[model samples]
Target: MGTTTEAENKPAESARRQKTRERLMDAAFEVFSEVGIHAATVEMITERADFTRGAFYSNFDTKEELFLALAERGYNERLELLRASVANIDVIMPTLLEQNPGSLTATELGPIVASFLEQQGDNRLWFLFQSELRLLAMRDPEVGKLFLQQKHAADQEFGNIIAAAFTAVGITPAIESVELAIVLMNTYEASLQEAIMAGGEKVQERAHELFMQRMLGLISQLAS
Candidate 1:
């Protein structure tokens, strides 16, 4: 029988470590969402992930670290979605222009923007987790600093996507891309919160509609 070489084992070991880290993050997301970060404990996360305490410690030094990691993951996921949405605009705009053959108005742009910005996964859970992070940042300076850094990076990336989308549609933004990204994100979050509060069978649908309407108006007012 051949013995396993360290070189061969290295890839397997790395894969295992990555899998562990992903599981822990997934579990932490749920726990943190259900109970605020302050209330969430390592044991709770471990139990949710069905891992030992040692596993959690091996993956993360502290809950705050895991929280930041989760935030980063969420931001990356959203950015990917935004990128995909922007890419679709390249395909969409030509057909739209062929049909209309003139400058596209807010009415024409609203659905595209809304489709890209539409909430994915569980909105209420995501909103709760996001709200918890914001509150924690307000109270904890260290976490706030880290959170802001991550948020700024995400905003910049999203801003690039926005810029790309504007270019695709031959529209010049009146304001900076980052500022526009921030405004649009804030508006989406506010609309989501309201929809969640409204409490109904179609909260996500309503949220999308509300955001699309607000976005159309903002686009009209903000774009030249």
Candidate 2:
């Protein structure tokens, strides 16, 4: 009876732990986005999360650890969004292909691509958090190693998505799919930084559209 009771309680304990970790991550994301990693404190994260410092410590060793967790969470979240968007496109693949026979041009599919990218979390706060991490990775060796690992994973996942999308449309990328994926991502990030520096959310929004325009031109040139 004792063993059975403990077994029954284990799932509930696991659920509680999962919820606590999620709350901490959400709070860390907000705090890091608002104040940045360098300035953020564990206390700030716990306070925002409505949990005790003990609760924070139970789940994470340090602010940097939580930030890394948030990065992984962000990556997973964006990938899910991308996957869902691609699934929707997949539903219309036959129609899309029929409409654009022969090699696909960016002009032909630019809106679809732009729409997919635009849906990828336009939160300014998240963007700020990402920008801060990128700078940290550039300057800090420890952080840079982790950041590069995360980037490589994201690039591979995103490259697979792009490869599937283009293959569905019967168009092969002029370059290797993963390389194309990295180039597109790097270009988008550069444009986003320019937008972030230029002004407010409005500029950032316009920047995505402008990025799509330029990306379309580039893809047109690259894709036959």
Candidate 3:
């Protein structure tokens, strides 16, 4: 078979190509986690992926391209988790209030706040990614633009939820809710990166607890 025909006839070719790409992406993720975004390279990624240089090039044009792709994938995935999570928001609140009110400022707001912090832990990888993107924002306009677009979308989504919560309570929602959500999203994304640098996961729990108490306490105060 000719080159095109040969590539087409192999039943496993499609799967192989996809599998190879995933390997590279996974490799890049590991390398970035270790040496960070600026230091990670195609060679390091390919080494971890156990693929040839040619294979890596075939799949991704450059390390930056791969990083950007991985970052986008991470963001989309976390968004799905957050969107799905709030579906159970009502039920989760009561469970949180019942189980761990002492950990928060008040029992009534524990669930939503705790749940968000938990999801924040789950989304730590993407959170690391935003840290890199922020550093590159002014230096690299394209990456900055993509990063900002995602951030704005997340902020708006959180703002919408806050607004709905206020409307439900028969109060005109404050503008600060939108601003707070934006700050909350940005701060959390940046904060996780700091926590990642401070030894390990132990710090994460502590940070989450403090953030939950503070932010949720503020929210409860506003709602009241």
Candidate 4:
């Protein structure tokens, strides 16, 4: 066999680095969710990831950077869910119309919208991580600025998705798409927090039910 050239090694090295980074992020997410950012440490994350402190440092300058990366990852995941839901509208809308053959009402539309916004990850863990980020943002101006930037970016993307969904269904939003997106997101978060606070065996199910109820009401008021 010929000696391995540096050029040939680059791709494998890059893949290994990416794998290491992802594992570190996964460990950090769990540790941060269990303990707030202020309480969580690099050692805790590296220990959970089964890596050394050097590995953590090589991937991230500080825990704050990793925290922000996690936030971005969460936003991207939600955006992907929204995109996937919207992409399936041709299939989904026909089925909805077949079941109820008329102009779609809030009752018909609410579930479609909810399906797009639903989280694919552990809801409680995501909520906890978000709560921690919010607390940190409130305490540190730099973090707050960065967090708001990410939130704004996510809002814009979600707004576009919402606009597309409404257009697909032939509904005119009473408010700006971004404004409506913000309201829906806040409502979903509130519903989730309420369900989590109540603490039961079916927290996710309860949250979805509560969101559907609230969403139908909001849709009725916001769409024509």
Best by lDDT: 4
lDDT of 3: 0.65
Candidate 2 minimal-lDDT segment of 10 residues: 109-118
C-alpha TM-score for every candidate: 0.87, 0.84, 0.77, 0.91
Predicted structure with the largest TM-score when compared to the true one: 4
Which of the two candidates, 2 or 3, achieves a greater TM-score against the reference?
Answer: 2
Descending-TM-score candidate ranking:
4, 1, 2, 3
Writing each residue's lDDT as its tens digit, candidate 1 over 1-224 gives 99999999999999999999999999999999988898999999999999999999998999989998898898788778777767676565567757754467756766655556663567777788989999989999998987798789878877787777766666777889899789888888889889988989897888888888788779876566
Q: List the residue pairs that clash in candidate 3.
A: none
lDDT preference between candidates 3 and 4, better one: 4
- What is the C-alpha lDDT profile of model 4 across 63-99, one tens digit per residue? 9999999998987887787677667766656787576
In candidate 3, what are the lDDT values of residues 1-224, reduced to their tens digit?
63567767686887889888888887787787667788877778888888889999998888888888887877676666666556555554565445654343333453454455466444565555566767777689998898888777776667666454344334443456668567556555454555666756675675565565556645654544
Evaluated against the true structure, the overall lDDT of model 4 is: 0.85
Instruction: List ranges where model 4 is wrong by over 4 Å.
Output: 92-94, 100-102
lDDT of 2 by residue, 1-224 (tens): 34568879999999999999999998889889889999999989899999999999899888888888888789889878877766777554556677776556656665555555667765566678898889888888988998898888778777777767777666777787778778877777777767777886596676777687688677775454
**Candidate 2 — which residues are off by over 4 angstroms?**
1-4, 92-98, 101-104
